[model samples]
Target: MINNSSHVNWRPTADIQSLRQRAVIIANIRQFFALRNVLEVETPCLSNATVSDLHMRAFCTQFNDPMSPQQKTLYLQTSPEYAMKRLLCAGSGAIYQIAKAFRNEEAGKYHNPEFTMLEWYRPDFDHVQLMNELDELVQQIVGCEPSNRMTYQQSFKEHLSLDPLSASLEELQKRGCALGYEHICRDEQDKDTILQLLFSHEIEPNIAKQRPCFIYDFPASQAALARINLQDQRVAERFELYYKGIELANGFHELANVSEQRQRFDADNAQRRAFDLPPVVTDEFFLAALESGLPNCAGVAVGIDRLIMLALNKTKIAQVIAFNYQNA
Candidate 1:
């Protein structure tokens, strides 16, 4: 015999009032983009490839076919970027997508495994133009002007008194220890970890308290796929928008070099190997498209659920999601 008297904690769903507000904001956003002639699109959630970024983890699935002794692998896309860029290469005009993206390791007050993302690309536009448009889009959605803009170098110098473009690994480690970092890496380090630590601790909390802020001109090593600014050879033309100290979006001046991109992808896989993680096969289709020709463009992605939560002053991401991970 089993005991049958267990009580279940039945938490309610997202607040209806907040949901309505989110709906309104989304509607307005659609109107803004539609008026600007941006074509809305949808891409598959599952794919054979995933982002090459070392930090982002993708969820994988396996399929077995009975007709033949064959197995297939699929990944829940971390971002819709690859597919959207393929469309760009195929001459799709200015396009945007409201997509549900997945990540495996992210779960916290401000993060969930699954969340909504608003991604867009503008052909023939540089990162500067996209930055301005980011400001306009946020203001139009929130009905308020954002704060101001600052470069990555300026931000680091102002907050940590460290030059991110030239700071040594030892200096970064020292700063991290001084700031109460318990898990500092002793091995040879790169700029990414140092920048992430500083951004999360010193700079992020102090940004956009009054309004939104755009932190642009990232170090060249952190460019990912963004193009380096010709005037500033040490920095890439990329920007991240922050609102109330929460990161809302990231944009890039697309790098259209196929060979360079392939090399970066290989490097990422090599890093994965060093970390004892399995390397994903490269997306040959996307690479072939790049080889053929991708339009000169700028692209960006905004966290929609975060935006909704911000609009309602909700602190926990679970409050906005229909079913939190534990519940799911």
Candidate 2:
């Protein structure tokens, strides 16, 4: 005897209207890219490796093979970045993908274990150019006002009155403490980590409230897959778009040097060790693609659900998606 009544609350989180609006927006996005000749593409949802970023967690599952006497663990891709870049190395011209990505993270109004991502790459385009195109796309879909561009240094200076580029570790920590964050964890006291904490807590809420904006040229330490600026080695050619102080996208001038990428991956593993987190293995296939000459390109990943949320004036991501994590 089992009970299967109304206790489950089995219904979609989003309404029918939202689903229709989402479809229209997605169609518009495809048309926007199609006009620019950017081909839509797809990649595997599972991967042999995972993100090395110290802040993110990846979900994993075991795969057993009948033809072989071994079981291999597969990670749900946190982003389709590495695989997409492999396609770029294979000379798949300008490409875009609306993908489902996964990350084991704290559930919140803005976060889910599984979410939709709109990612793309453009050859011969720098981060600046990508920002321009992204701004156009956002305006086209969400009808936001034209976005403005600001450098990361300018943002920190305007908001905190501190120079993030040359700020010492002690200075950053001191600022964090002054901002009432005295009990931060020991493992998270690194320069970039502290900077991110300050940015998210103090700065993000105040940026681009009236219109969208792009903040570019991030600290070299926080580059991730972005290439470092040649003229100013202290910063990397990375940018993020924000609307009403909410982050909408992140872009980077793709790092093409194999040796430098390997070094960055090792550095990430070292940081993971410092934080007592399991070190993630580097994706050799991605590195091999880089070695075989990835074309010079700029790339970005956007949150489609978030975009839908903004478009519908919905506060929670669940209001824009068919099923949220809990409901699903």
Model 1 pairs in collision:
none
lDDT of 1 by residue, 208-290 (tens): 98889999999988888899899989999999999887899999999999998999899999998988888878998889989
Question: Could you say which candidate leads in TM-score?
Answer: 2
C-alpha RMSD (angstroms) for model 2: 1.3
Measured on C-alpha atoms, candidate 1 has an lDDT of: 0.87
Give the per-residue Cα lDDT of candidate 1 at 20: 78
Winning candidate number (lDDT): 2
Indicate the residue-level lDDT of 322 in model 1.
69
Query: If scored against the real structure, what TM-score would every candidate get?
Result: 0.94, 0.97
